[model samples]
Target chain A: MKFNVKIEVMLKPGHSDPEGETTARALRELNYPIESVSVSKVYMVVLEAGSKAEAEKMADGMCRRLLANPTKDDYRFEIRETR
Target chain B: MKFNVKIEVMLKPGHSDPEGETTARALRELNYPIESVSVSKVYMVVLEAGSKAEAEKMADGMCRRLLANPTKDDYRFEIRETR
Candidate 1:
């Protein structure tokens, strides 16, 4: 079976997000009532596995190995069966 | 009302995704059964607005103006009321 995985990686609370901060500053200058903006990453991967559980395990391993930074980022994923 | 908006920006189909391609190459080298990987960006914005409609409008405007490159990327957003 094939699975389409969507993973999101974001900085943990209390981490400084310079990119997000700079973006918020720019937006505020553009005259929108914005409090803050934090940026993250999303990865879409298409892979095949024997079962959903196997897909989940592979997805988790991918996040731990390359897709997310363990020290500073919190990551989550959703796996959906695809044609 | 305070709203939490999640905006996702991804390269349009047929556009080269160098970052994603590199990541996939690295992953394959590490021995994971992966076909392809595509990367996208997510922006989490916290702001206050009079209503959901107003929040949506502001978010759409933000994407149009700065968050996304309209010609090469496709974007979508979700807004939820926050405390």
Candidate 2:
């Protein structure tokens, strides 16, 4: 079966987000009434797997091994069968 | 009112995604069955806006002006009132 997977990787709270901070500052300068901003990476993967369970497992492995940094990042993913 | 906005920026079809290609290669080397991979940027913005419409408008402007490249990228955002 083929599956479509979406993974969101984010910095853990308490970790400083310089990019977010910089963007927020720029937004403020541009007069947008923004309180704060945070940024994350989202991965869209299309892959072949035996089942939904298998797809999720593979995505989780990908996140742990390469997509996210354990100490500072947290990751979540969703898997759906492709039509 | 305060709104929480989530924006996703992605490369349009036909545009090259080097990062995605590199990651896909790494995944394949790791022996995960994969057809293709694409990556996007997700921005989480917390801001004060007069209404949801205003929030969305502001986010759209942000995307057009700074967050997304007009030629090769597309963006979408969702705004929700924060409790």
Task: For candidate 2, write residues A22-81 as lDDT tens digits.
Answer: 989998988898899999999999999998988989999999999999999999999999
Q: Compared to the true structure, candidate 1 yields what TM-score?
A: 0.97
Which stretches of model 1 miss by more than 4 angstroms? none
Listed in order, the DockQ scores are: 0.89, 0.91
Could you tell me the lDDT of residue A19 within candidate 2?
94
What is the Å distance of residue B55 in model 2 from its true position?
A: 1.0
Chain B structural similarity (TM-score) per candidate: 0.97, 0.98
After superposing candidate 2, which stretches have Cα over 4 Å from the reference? none
Q: After TM-score superposition, what is the CA distance of residue B36 in candidate 2 from its true location, in Å?
A: 0.7
Give the clashing pairs for model 2.
none
Model 1 lDDT on a 0 to 1 scale = 0.93
**Count of steric clashes across candidates, in order:** 0, 0
